[model samples]
Target: MTIRKATFDETQRILDYALVVLKESTMGFVKPRVEIANLIMAPILADGGYYLIYEKNRTIHGWIGVGTIYDSYSEEVVGTIPEVYVFPAYRGQGVAEKLFHEAFRHLKTENVNKVQLNVFAGNHAKKLYEKIGFHDVSTLMEKDLD
Candidate 1:
C-alpha cells in the first residue's frame, strides 16, 4: 500500500468514502451526496487544506483530510485533521497510521507547530491517536435540542 496526496480526478472516490464515514457517525441528517462532497473538497482543492489517500493495487482503500488553523493570539499555524477513514477490509493493517504519519510529515514541512484531530467518542481510532503521542487537551460537549 502507498500513501500519497490525492489528485483532482480522485475527488469522487474521496467523496464516496467521506459519505460512508458521515453516515456511520451521524444520525438524522440528510444532504445530497454531491453537495456535501463539493463542500468538503472545495477547500482541499483550493490549497487551503490537505487530502491524502491510501491505495493498493490501484484501488483506493482510505483517505484523510486536514485543514490549517491560524491562531491569532499565538500567531501560530495549527493543523486540524477533520476526517480519516479506512475501508473495513483495510482496518487493523496500519493503513490509518501510515496515512497520518505521511500527512504529519508534510504538515511539519509547512511549519505547522501542532496537529489536532477529533475522534467520535468510543471510536477505536482514539486509541491509535493516543498511542501516537496525542494527549487530551480539551473536551468538547454538545447537546441536542431537537
Candidate 2:
C-alpha cells in the first residue's frame, strides 16, 4: 500500500468508507450520511490541515486527517491526528502504519512538538496508537443522559 495526499476527486470515496466504518461500529444511523463527507473533508480543506490517504491497486484502503491547533493563550502549534480509519477488510495490512509515519513527517515540518488523538478507552486502535509511539497522556469521559 502507498500513502499519499488525497485529491478533491478522491475525497468523496474516502467519505463513503468512513461512514461505513462509523455506522458499523456505532450501531446507529448517521444523522445525515453527507455529514460524514464534511467530517472527512473539512479539516483537510482548512488553512493548515491535511488528509493522507492510503491506497492499494488504485483502490482507497484507509485515511488519516491532521490539523494544527493553536492554543490562543500560548499560540503554540500542536498537531492533532483528528481521524483515522481503515476498512475492516484492510485492517492489519499496515496501511495505518504507513499513513501515520508520513503524517508524522508532515507535523515535524510544521514544528509540532507533539501530535494528539483520542481513542475510546477500550478501543483496539488504542493499541495501534501505542504501538506507533503514542501514550495515554489523557482520559476522556462522558455521561449520556436520555
lDDT score for residue 43 of model 2? 64
lDDT of 2 by residue, 1-146 (tens): 67888887776666656655555534453443757746644764576576799888988888888787765545786888767888778989898888899999988987888887756554677788989999977565677798
Residue-level lDDT of model 1, residues 106-134, one tens digit each, is: 88888887988766676667889999878
The TM-score values for the models, in the order shown, are 0.80, 0.78
**Least accurate 10 contiguous residues by lDDT in model 2:** 23-32
Structure candidate 2, residue pairs in collision: none
Q: Could you report the Cα RMSD, in angstroms, for every candidate shown? A: 2.8, 3.1
How many Å off is the CA of 18 in candidate 1? 2.6
